[model samples]
Target: MSPRQRDRVRSLVADSEAPIDAQTVAAELSVHVTTARFHLNNLVEEGSAIAINLPPIGVGRPRVGYRLVVAPPVDDLMLMLVARLGETPEQREELAAEVGRAWAAKHLPSVAIDAELVPDPVVLAETILTRLGFRITDVVSAFGQHEITLCGCPLEKIEHELPEVARGVVRGLLETALTAGSPALAAQYAVAVRPAPGGKCELRLNLAQVADSTAR
Candidate 1:
C-alpha cells in the first residue's frame, strides 16, 4: 500500500459509524462507488477492514458492509515466512491443512460424542465458512455430486502459490463435518479442489464415490 493510497482510505471514515458500505464511503468522499469499492477492497486485503453482508428484511439481496479493523500487522511477515518453511510441497500442504483443522477444532463447538444421532456435517461447513469471510457464489448438486463456489479466500495471500492454505481450510471443514457427522459415512466421502479466477475456488464432495467404495 502506498502512502497516498493509505491516506485516502484512512481519511474516509475516521469518525463514522462502523460497518459502512462502499456506497456510503463514495457518497461522503464525492467519488464513484466503484472507486470507493476498489479502495475498500484494498483495505480488506490489507487487513485494515472487514467485509460482511447483512441480510435485509425484504426480499432483495443482502447489503454488503465494511467494518474498520484496527490492529498491528504483527503476524503478516511471520505467517509468510512460516508458510514457506516446509521440507517439500506435500509437507507444506499437510502442515497448512493441519493448521486449518486445528483452527476449526478450537473455534467450533465440540461434536457430540457417543450420542444418539450425528447429522450431516457438510451443512454446517457452509455456515462456518461464511462467518470466517468466504461468500458462497453458488451450489451445484446433481448425480450425487455436490459442488460449491466461494467468492473470496479467507487468507489474503495470493492463491496460486499458497493453494495449500485454501485446501487446508476445505479439509478442515470436511474433517470436522466427518467427526461430527457419521464416521462410517464420512469415511466414504472425499474432497476435490479446483482453483478459480479472482481469489475464488470450487470444492467438490461426491457421494457417488460411496457406491464405488462400498463395492471395494
Candidate 2:
C-alpha cells in the first residue's frame, strides 16, 4: 500500500472516539471498502485498534467496527519515517508519484480503455471516487484541463495532520485515473489536488501534450 493509503487508515482508526465501520471508513478515506477492511483487520492484530460488534437493529448477526486503542508516541517508528522523508521534499514527492503510478498499473487493466479518446475522463474518475464516498460537487473543463471538485476527506479531517501523505493519495488517484481512463493521452503529465472552500477538495488535472515517458 502507498503511504497515503496506510497513513489515512491509521489516522481514521486512531482519531475516532467510537468504533467505526469499514464502509464508513472507506467513504471517509476515499478507499474501497475491501481496502478499509484489510487495513483495519491488520490494525486489530497489531493491537493499535480493537474490533467490536455493533448491536443489531433487527438482524441475526451484529455489525463489526473498529475503535482506536492506542496512540503512536512522538518517537514512534512511523513518525520517524515521515520525518525522515520530510527531510527531502523532492524525493518525498517522487515517492508519492510512484504510489500513484503503481496503483494505476494495478487497477487500470480492469478499467476498459477505448481506442479513441473517451468523453471527459473526469466522469469516470468521479464514479470511482464516489463509490468510495468522496462526493463530487462538480466537474468542468477549462484551460485544457479537467477540474474536479470533491467534498469530504477520506482521512476524516486528519488531512492537515499528514498533508503530504494525504495529497500523495490524491495524486495517485488522479494520475491513475487519467492514464487508465485516457490511454491516448497517457503521456507524461502532472496533477494537483488542493483543499477548497465550503469544506471541499479541488483536483486540477494538468493534462499536457503526450511525450515519451516512463511510469513513476
Candidate 3:
C-alpha cells in the first residue's frame, strides 16, 4: 500500500458514520477485496483503527467492521527519505525493489551449484527470511503449491508505510536465491506476498506452467 492508498483507506474509515467493512472499502476504492482487507488489517495493527464484530444483518456470520481510533505517534524520517528517492510513486517503488535486490545479493551465499547439490527454493527462502528477522510459524505444501507463513517482520514500519517495497524485498530475496541455485525452479515457480494481521505475511510459491523438460 502506498501512502496515498492508506490515506484514502483512513479517510474512508474516518468519514463513515458506522464501522466500515472491507467489502465497502473495496467498492469505494475500486480495489480488490483482498487489497482493501490487507490495508484495513494493517491499520488495526498500527493502532489507527479497531476491528469490531458488527451485528449480523441477515446471515451466516457477522461481518467484521473497522472503526477509526486515535493513531499512535509515528516516525516520519523513513517516509521522508523515501520521498526524496523518486519524483513519483512508481519510480520510488522501482527504486525500492532495486534496493531489495541489492540487499539480497549482498547477503546471500555464493556457493557454486553442482549437479548433485541443487538447493531447494523453499529452504533457501526460509533461511533468507530468518536472516531478515522473520519467524516462520507454518509451512504447508501439497502437489506443486507451497506456502510459508511468517510472523514478526523487522520491516513492519516500512510495510505499513510502503508495502510495495516490503513486498519487493520478499520477491527479491526469493528470486535471487532461486536464480542462484536452481534457475529451473525459478522458471517453474514464482513467489508472491499475501498480507496478514499482526505484522505477518504469507509467502506463496505458485508453480508456473512450463514445458515438462524445462523445469529439469
lDDT against the true structure, per candidate, is 0.63, 0.66, 0.74
What does the lDDT read for residue 100 in candidate 1? Answer: 66
List, residue by residue over 1-216, the lDDT tens digit for candidate 3.
689988999999999989999999999989999999999999899888999998877876998999999644455766667667677766766677677678878887777777556566678778777877777887777776677777635667776777666666676676777777777667777666656545344333333334563643
Tens digit of per-residue lDDT, candidate 1, span 64-150: 787778765765765677578576756776776677667766666655555555554446557656766777777777765666666
Clash pairs (backbone) in predicted model 2: 28-154, 29-154
Residue pairs clashing, model 1 = none
Instruction: Indicate the worst ten consecutive residues by lDDT in candidate 1.
Output: 199-208
Per-residue lDDT tens digits for candidate 2, residues 1-216, read: 677788888888678878888888889978899988999999888888889999865866787899877665753565456545555655665665576567555654375567675546666567556655677777777665666667646643434455565566667766777667775554545567666654534433333433455652
What's model 2's overall lDDT? 0.66
Clashing pairs in 3: none
Worst ten in a row by lDDT for model 3 = 200-209
RMSD of candidates 1 onward, in order: 16.2, 16.1, 18.2
The predicted structure with the larger lDDT, 1 or 3, is 3
lDDT of candidate 2 at residue 43, scale 0 to 100: 85
**TM-scores, each model vs. reference:** 0.53, 0.49, 0.54
For candidate 2, report its TM-score: 0.49
Using TM-score as the measure, which candidate wins? 3
